[model samples]
Target: MERSSAHRTPGDPVAGMALPVYIVCGGTGGHLAPGIATAQRLIRAGISVELVVSEKEVDSRLLESYPDLNYRRVKGAPFRLSPKGLFLFVLHNTRSFISGFQYLRKNPPAMILAFGGFISVSYVIAAWLLKVPIVLHEANRVVGRSIRFLSGMADTVFLPDGVSLAGIEARRIRRLGMPLREEVKHVSKETIRREMDIPHHAKVLVVVGGSQGAKALNDWVEETHKSLASDGIWIILVTGPGKNQMPELKVLQSDMGVDVEIRTFAFHRSLHELFSCADVVLSRAGAGTVAELVCCLAPSILVPFPYAADDHQLANAQDLERRGGCIVIDQKNSSNLYREVLDLIFNDWLLGRMRQNLRRLNHGDAAENLTKQLIESYYPGHLRATAVENSTEAKEAVNG
Candidate 1:
């Protein structure tokens, strides 16, 4: 069998110079966060990086704080089965491919690392045409359509634990854990409680509804907050930054009276702190969220978005459930949501057991490990040595 493109011979430029890497992780925060975490690892190791993302409002809001990194944007739409939608998908993809090809031809990187999404399709195609090594990481428990279509062409495929990707050669897939931010690894529960000004003994519940709040989940939480708060459970709700008016949090606090601590924020940049302090989490089953929960050892009640691609979020949640890391609550029968939440909150033994299971499921040092593998797989040792040396000299010159 022919080796994947990643095993192809390296060019003199790639072998002798410090070449930048292009990471395509657009669409949602689930795709973007892992890409950013992996890119951060490469950057700290003296490699230059460029990020290609979709020109969506959510992307802009999530990426606005990372001014130190380079970024480029393209317009993308979800795949639709209708004729008009298909035509638009083709037209947008063709334009994206042409733009990507033009840019890479002018300023090519040594490789492209793609996190699955429609926006990444064009970037992967452009890199393949340029003969740059391509690596694909699919964070979903089930393979996404774009990645499934493009997998045969990738040099390597990386997955988070518990993904049973069939058809692809077992040799081609490696479980690299989830690419997570450095901060996700180091949050302290004590520090988080202090920062949020919570009493030391108070039990904390965190509600995560994705980048835009899940209206159903928020509504449920709103209706049940008074009872939960009265039981001495403090709620930290991340409603996301949407145009919708948030629940009257202050009024809710008044209704619950001083005994309950109910704090609401439209968004929080440091979600690790929130997760770190959580006794239990109520959240959607996005791959990034599950991975973060595992890292933080937070047991959760996962509500999968019923409309997600191929019902993949359901697959993610079920995998966690099977592993004893979480309990799955179907969106359709969410009438029992409060009961489930209360059960987890009140049952210390069950929560502790789930936490133990979650810890066993974590993939340690994911970003650092993946960075080392990418460098070793695609670049020769001398190239890394030269790159580091040149980077050191440049820094020294700037300082001097």
Candidate 2:
């Protein structure tokens, strides 16, 4: 396969060619967030990126904040065995595959970086057929079905530390952590709390249910907020889109006549603020959410979405738990959630320890490292050689 013009230097003959890296990451925030993060890094390095996303509303909503990103929405459906489900899956995927193939044939990319999802299946196959190098990043502890299916065809598969896929060649796999967004870094707790008008001394509990709100977690907050508020815990609840109609802020009085505060939102664009301000977080254990928690050093009580495919959320939470970054509570035993939250929140020692562990787990350079690897894979030793040459030229020019 011919090398794409994307990696060429500006003075190269074909440098102005329009070939861009195509990132297939859609369906959920988990997939799309990392894709956007990596895309941002690539764009800063002078590599153009076009995101390939699904036709899901969530994808559109997520991309709304990223109007500058070039993206295409492809129709896709998850695989299902039922007759009707199977028919829709085949029909949608066939259309996606045809569209993807035609596009790639016309404007071949330097490479296709796919964050595993049903949306990626057709694109990966199309890229493979066109001999485009493919790279897969699996953020979860257990590999997803899409990555598992597409792994063999990929030039490289990036997995979290200590995680591996069964069938892929060991040489093809690399240990890299999740790529977090630029906005995911931590801010001072006091700074954010003051900005949000939260009390300085308030014990804050933040509940996040992922892109689509967790009804169980939402209900738990609804049932227990009053009691929690009575104990002087301020609540920041993200109820997902359209799941609740509560006003953004509410003030209540406890039996002891102490004023209590609760803030609720359908979705929050500034998650770093909430996570940084949180004393303890109650959240579903999606890999992206776990990575954000680690980035913010927010000690959390993770409730894995029991219905997650292949129980991947459980696996993700377990890995974090083993690393001492979090406490995992099975959704089935959520009755223990209130007690766990109370226990963790009041125990300053445990929370501090968990925060310390999370700091150790934070792979702050994951995006930069992944971007370097992706470029290196396409043009072996080219980046390093260019950097050395540039450095030498710069020094010579200065000395001369």
Candidate 3:
């Protein structure tokens, strides 16, 4: 079925094109990581992928390693508390929506995957106006305001199992587990430790402060450094950018008499590697962090950020804790973190049980499952051969 260039549309960058999936995910690693993982899976199944992302510093740094995918930026701003800030935010959002509409009109994809951010809201609206089929994913147990508003227009809303959004008008809802990088499943612990210069014998407690730095979490760790050191735990603290004083922390580590290795980084692109080297993760319960901890089978002490939208981080932590995978410490009562750490370290059986529970929460094939669903439900006739091949590959993966 050879086609001439004359039939090629201006909207498409490539000629003689089949339908590509357009993914709108940006701002933070939580949205971007899953989007990239899913895009990688789709590409492997011979599907084209184009991403619409924000040019936020974190987004740019994260996307640098993924050069094969096609991505463009749409300017975005968060809603502000002040009236003047609100006006500017609205103005920026309006321009973003217009930009998204123009891009979609030019390079219309087969469908859109909205990964729940304010930036994604604009693109989702543009896709709706263009009559493009859309699948929305809300990573948290409690839906984000943007995704809740756009749910009515989404063809399908994908959520984690047992999560429910009350009074959503989506055409259909499905439980498609969180998508994660392939490296999370395959990276060796020894290799990760060697790369980080952490000793294999040292019990590692990796502190992740999410994509944006958590000042409270960092302060807590610094305050409790001596206690943590007394327990013979080496800490790999990933201190995200903004108000970072890693040099001071290093100096403090050198002064301490306790035998604890406290290595700090502003940010590390390879977080999966850090997770692999961890015996216990002391982290803020972002949805992405929870998914990764579960995927890596790491025991954790989750402290949900109180100010997160709708207190969704708390819900995320609660869900994992309910399954006996981790202990949740309320940020307001964060003094409990030290006690929880002692309990985890002393109770060998507890740590192992939690790790076992965490392992049960892993969904390594989430991206593949989502890809299969999209092919079967929306474009059944379009990629029959590729779909069959993917099906066989999935079976072989499970059997092997």
Q: What is the TM-score of each candidate against the true structure?
A: 0.89, 0.92, 0.87
Q: Which candidate leads in TM-score?
A: 2
User: Per-prediction RMSD in angstroms?
Assistant: 4.1, 3.7, 6.2
lDDT of 1 by residue, 1-400 (tens): 2344453455445533467888999888888888889989988877788999998776788787688889899977778899999988999989999999999889978788999999988888877877777889988888899888778767789987667666789887888777887667636778878887777677788998877667777777678788777666788888776723455354334233556667787776777778889888899998888888888888899999999999999999998999999999999989888888878888999988998898888756888998988877656664558788999999999999
Alpha-carbon local distance difference test for all models: 0.81, 0.87, 0.80
Model 3, 263: alpha-carbon shift in Å? 0.7
User: How many residue pairs of model 3 clash at the backbone?
Assistant: 2
Between candidates 2 and 3, name the one with more favorable lDDT: 2
Q: What is the lDDT of residue 74 in candidate 2?
A: 96
- Superior candidate under lDDT, 1 versus 3: 1
Candidate order, TM-score descending: 2, 1, 3
Clashing pairs in 3: 11-106, 11-107
Q: Rank the candidates by lDDT, best first.
A: 2, 1, 3
Model 1 residue 19 lDDT score? 72
Candidate that would win on lDDT: 2
lDDT by residue (tens digit), candidate 2, 272-305: 7799999999999998898889889999999999
